[model samples]
Target: MTLWNRLLLGLILLSSCWLGLAVTPSPVATKPNVIIIMADDLDSRQLSCYGGKNLKTTHIDALANEGLKFNHIYASEAMCVPTRASLFTGLYPVRHGSFQNHKPVYDTLKSVGHYLADLGYRVGLTGKDHSTKPKTVFPFEIVTGFEPNCVAPTDDYQLNDVRKFITRTNQPYCLFVMSINPHTPWTVGDTTEFDADKLILPANWIDTPVTRRQFVKYLAEVRRLDEQVGEITRLLKETGQDKNTIVVFLGEQGAQFPGAKWNLWDVGQKSSMVVKWPGTVKARTETDALVQYEDITPTLVDIAGGKPIAGLDGKSFLPVLLGKSSTARPYAYGIHNNIPEGNPYPIRSIRDTRYKLILNLTPDEEYYNRFMMNAKQKDRNSVWFSWIDQAPNDPNAKRITDRVVKRPAIEFYDTQKDPWELTNLATDPTHQNRIRQYRQKLETWMKQQGDAGAALDIVYAKKKE
Candidate 1:
């Protein structure tokens, strides 16, 4: 223990301490840029990335190749406002109480964007924010994330504006890019300079002359949307942020067709979901695991290491994204409540991997005939509405519309056999056992989630008085 020996030992201790400090992971390493590109009323079967033949989505296809694509992703509610609200709040439409299109989403609940903003991330939204009620008066500085230099109603140019925002932002950011291109008013020609003839019709859709013409217009809009996606991806690559940012592309709901958006069928609830997280998620992977729009908020929060609020219906699938084996929720719940000028007061559904059970709260006649007049009125302004109405004029339309509108009180479908869900097997004795099991499960879930519908009888009684 001489003076020289003591000095050497002290130096060794100091070096060890310094090495430990140098190797510690920084907070920045845990944070990643999050960008969600949400499409309005998009169907999974309509994208090239999802085996859609009618449309060419090169950019989105590239994203799917580079990341994981979900085969069975759904919106909590099959409508714009409610689905968006569920995505933001991680709650069901009944819980959030923003069940209708024009209904406002309350700001008191925490949103993924708000959480990121609180955690020192620059948050912005572009295109469409269909949250009926956005909590913050001025939640985002850049509305639709479009730059001042960009022209309006042009998908390509608007996406360029999004890229500009990403470059201009000084901090880590969460950008919600909402697209309205594939929505309604299917453009016949180049409303925004994209090819229309290259578009193909969906295999399931009828190939009649009228159907073909209608589908061509719809395909043109889908192409426009794909172009916008391409531009956004190009922007990310140009900025050198493609590898660092986690890009998620999803549809708010299904295609805006008859018995689609407002119904509880696969065509209404199922949507396209693609996620690209470089270095973490494996490329060219596809997952058939069931995921809901409500799960998006929790997953984002988990990735960002932000605090999750209590009573959220969604469970985060970060492990699934990171190429790890994990257990997701066993089932997803769906509600088809109010649609403008359309109704069947309240309908609830439960979908597992194989089967879907729908409970019609209103009788068939009351739900169909009562709403026919209102639907006809809505057709006055909406091309989709007008087209759907023309179904009665054509025998085929009559058949399709009849199956859609004359839904039974309780309907069951084997999702594996019937992805479009054109058939109802509720009355089939062979499937009676499966139907009962799902019905009971739905009731139990409703009770567990404190669903207002579970107490609908009481609520209606009080309302009558």
Candidate 2:
């Protein structure tokens, strides 16, 4: 062979190597993945990790032990769809036009899917899909499994679709796993594990044989939910994605009890939120920072190395997560506009760490919701009837029944001292000054959110340009 021929062959090999290097993808292109697991109708206090005495939640407690557990996080609305919408869009229900349950947000609104997708992440949803309508607004790649009732009496909840989505994708992803557990018809899980006679009831709960029976069944479902959480986290760890992924578990809303589900009180709005980010967030930490469902989207966006978007009701709680900020917000607001589902009993509330003031806009009318009223009236267990039956005989039982149905114009409570919110301090002369200050705060907030007050009852219409 000639020397010139050998030189030419060598040059060809060097050029091929150069071309391969030029075409290779950069390591920076692989961003961190995010996984959000949301549970339905479970409150923070229902979990043993959050000081729950009634039941033990071993799996969720492990996550809390390994991540940051937030003490004062809340849902923007007490119902499902509205709170879910707020979490995705980083806007309050009224601002997002989904203040009512089963209502859709305005057509133009974009969600976390859009924001994360912009940064080259594949966004997908599994389990419950109760977000706003037009479908395009959320735009998540749908994954299936865990669609049955909370108390369906079957352990058929599968995560195959979600697992396949993760394994198939080489790119980073944002996966939302919604678990429809502890919602209603409480029939799933081992009811026998929780002895009705031995179960400890909440301070506000009326102690009756039927009430105890139903409460134990509800506790059983909560235990089942904790098992599901364990399964999801175990999968992430086994797949070697747990380290790079930020796993968030949220108690979507309060339990479906009489005073908790549809109201704007602490039990209704407070949620259990735990976040695990291997490197960025310090483990085994707890924060008392005030955060709402509206803040979730922005915080996730910031965690994914994205810039903050403008005109959002929620400010990112990234600082709180990173141990840089101790306080997230001074106050968290709540609104409940009951229509279509029940009577037009509009309520607005504002709460700081210690104080809370609730304004019942339609105080002249009785508060009514068909589902809740039916639960009391049509309950086969006669739990609610027992409360009403003993109302006249027992003053405490009477107070509980009256508080469930009746409403005054204004109600105030120092939640620090009155967590159950039994006593109304709005009429107390000693709290008159405090009441006036909170009233002004509530009104200012209403105006800022463009709330139409009682006018919300007369069918909400979009304002003209």
Candidate 3:
């Protein structure tokens, strides 16, 4: 062969080798690791990252600074069992049918953990597992990827279980860390020490002497919860999985206080949501887009490059997190129900960016008075109760208490003007047109979703007097 032909042949071979290297798939990025950290009965207002001042949550704040923070996030329901069930199934409480805290509904639907395991990703749940009955078969029968380790209803053993799993796992995995901290019974000393005086009361809540005192205790509990979160994040870093894993931190429901946990108010359904996806999400980008707890499953599925289950009530926010602008949810729905011996059947609400409308199906005075009555029994000495009990004698207290207790069948609040929802505009003639519009929207949604409330006789028999 000629020298020129030999040189041409050598150059062509080199070019072919470079093209092959460029076209190869780069290992597919290994199905990113996922970690969901859930706090029980935590309020968004209690987190420093969410404009809270009572406790310092430096670790969570750091995570928020590194990723996306959702301002208008909501829970599926204002109660534990239902909210967690919705998170797993990407459905509503009525559809999943886990109506109360003691009722476990994992058997009725597939869990996100199980789906991930089926797709070859290791999955495990540590800490509180409130989905299944104490001895009922969990959705994931064999722990296909990682062993199941959960905290006892009254014990803190799950923390160690989570640490062990992270340390031992050798494959890409998903870990659901459910913390029992910050739930009711307000005890101190489990995780961190905090002073009561540091707590800040919400503007809507009465700033009476009693309310201030209760806030102190509540603030301490929030700080302790923050420490637990810090410990978990530190473990991720220690295991060297912090950068590769996407961490989602949020609350299961609102605080377990009056008009908070078992009510449809913002305090009951609003949650603190922070997502940290090291390379994907932007640093400290905050969006007020409405997001529901059910959206969590779909979001994770998108991140894993897996197809979402059909008939899901959630939409993925993957585009928004990837720095895409002009992404937003139209509206968010919330439900409140099934407190032990609590009066009234149930309530539902829908909120857009500017306004919130609530429908009280069983709007009886007796039912609305149940929470106030319970407060008197649980904490007679509590400043909150003392102020309410003395309302008749104190004109100022009466003015505040009466307005909340005598709320109407339909309630409306211009969220932009009254974010705290202390004032009700349901009866005001000025908001009549707005009320009709929202009521129609709520009705259309209820009918389309086939809400059990529509077929109460078949789904939920009326109670005897």
Candidate 4:
């Protein structure tokens, strides 16, 4: 063997080693980045992936198709401020002190921004900024991309800021892209795309001309929301963060229709969450395991490699993400207060996988929502009136409206059999044991959380927004 031939072979081996090192994924590139996109006043049932008969939600459906579909995720409280606060603090509504709309969280609590940032991640938020208040607590790097107001006349937006924020550095990030769509006035989307006549009304709603017209407007905003999801996911792919990032899509709460929002029915309480993590979560999978918004932060912390924050009511569901087990919690609880929205109508609820029990504190007094049932001439377009106007002759309409206004102190439902919660099984003798058990669990949870029962339903001095 010649000395030159041996030297040439050694040089070739060294160059090949350097080439392999260059192509290996960097540590920063492999670190998980989280992007959570949330929708406003959405009816999970309105999405085609969740079995909606309305217009197809192409982008959102794709997320469900490619990620884990959470069949039983819920917002601890159905309102905006409370739900987001619960999500940030990993605490229930009462504990977070944002139990009502426009209410603020306890000024002392730490948020996901603090938790993740301490662990060396940039945490930022864009659009629909509600719970990011008292900047000292939330501390999320404020970025502008989507609209902040839910009631704005227009939703024109630019993604330049969002694009810059996510791709700005190699450091891992947690960015929340909040979208205010299908919320109120329902004026932001292309209403022309939907035919009011052909839309399929939810079984719980009365089939009326006005109801159909109002629903078409709602679905249009839902379409706009779909576009927002599509764009955000596309941005991730464009930046080459598609494979390593953990992407989540959340439906904030139910629509604003009567008996939908500000009530304890499944539509208002139940939300949709679809998550995708390349190489971690299995694609085209689902879990009936119960999860709530309160559990989200702890899971994020777990993803950040941190221990559970002591004293938090929520526990991480990282195992569920890894497909380690099917169950996260045995019961998911609920609460509602109708003070700022209307009169003092307080409610509490508890449910497992199959059954739900609701306790209406003041069942005798009629339930009212200032936004939906107001007598002002301007509110004439609300679908609540359509249900009322047709209630006289339409037996179906009469049953539904009466059910909405008059509530029994105790209500129970087999949600698996009745998805919309149309039948109240409270009086059914067969389910007495389930009702008793759930009520006991409900009382125990309330006591632990310092929930003041109906006393929490009074008006508070308005805080600075």
Candidate that would win on TM-score: 4
Candidate 4 segments exceeding 4 Å error = 1-29, 378-380, 463-465
**lDDT tens readout by residue for model 3, 1-465:** 999999997888789898774434457557778888788788878788888776668878988998999888888578887888888778887677666444555354666766676676777776565674422334432222221232223324335556666656567788776777666555553323544444467665655666665566555666666776788788788878888989988877877565677778888888888999987888888988778888888888888888877888888888877877545588888766644436445678988878999987766653443434565475533554765877878776776666556556888998889877877888899989888988888778777767766233123432332
Q: lDDT of all predictions, in order shown?
A: 0.71, 0.84, 0.71, 0.90
User: What are the models' TM-scores?
Assistant: 0.82, 0.90, 0.84, 0.94
lDDT of 4 by residue, 98-169 (tens): 898878888889989989998889999999998898998799999998899988988888999999999999
lDDT of 3 at 285: 86
- Candidate 1, residues 330-431, lDDT tens digits: the string is 788888665453543577899877889998877544443222235546642243344465776776656665666565788888888887676789899999
lDDT value for candidate 1?
Answer: 0.71
| Top candidate (lDDT) | 4
Over 339-436, each residue of candidate 2 has an lDDT whose tens digit, in order, gives 76588888888887788899899888888777766664576446667777788889999888888788898999988889889888888899899889
Pairing residues by index, what is the TM-score of model 1? 0.82
Candidate 1 Cα misplacement greater than 4 A, ranges: 1-30, 144-161, 188-208, 366-397, 454-465
> Once model 2 is optimally superposed onto the true structure by TM-score, how far is the C-alpha of residue 233 displaced, in angstroms?
0.6
Q: Is candidate 1 or candidate 2 better by TM-score?
A: 2
Worst 10 residues of 4 by lDDT: 21-30
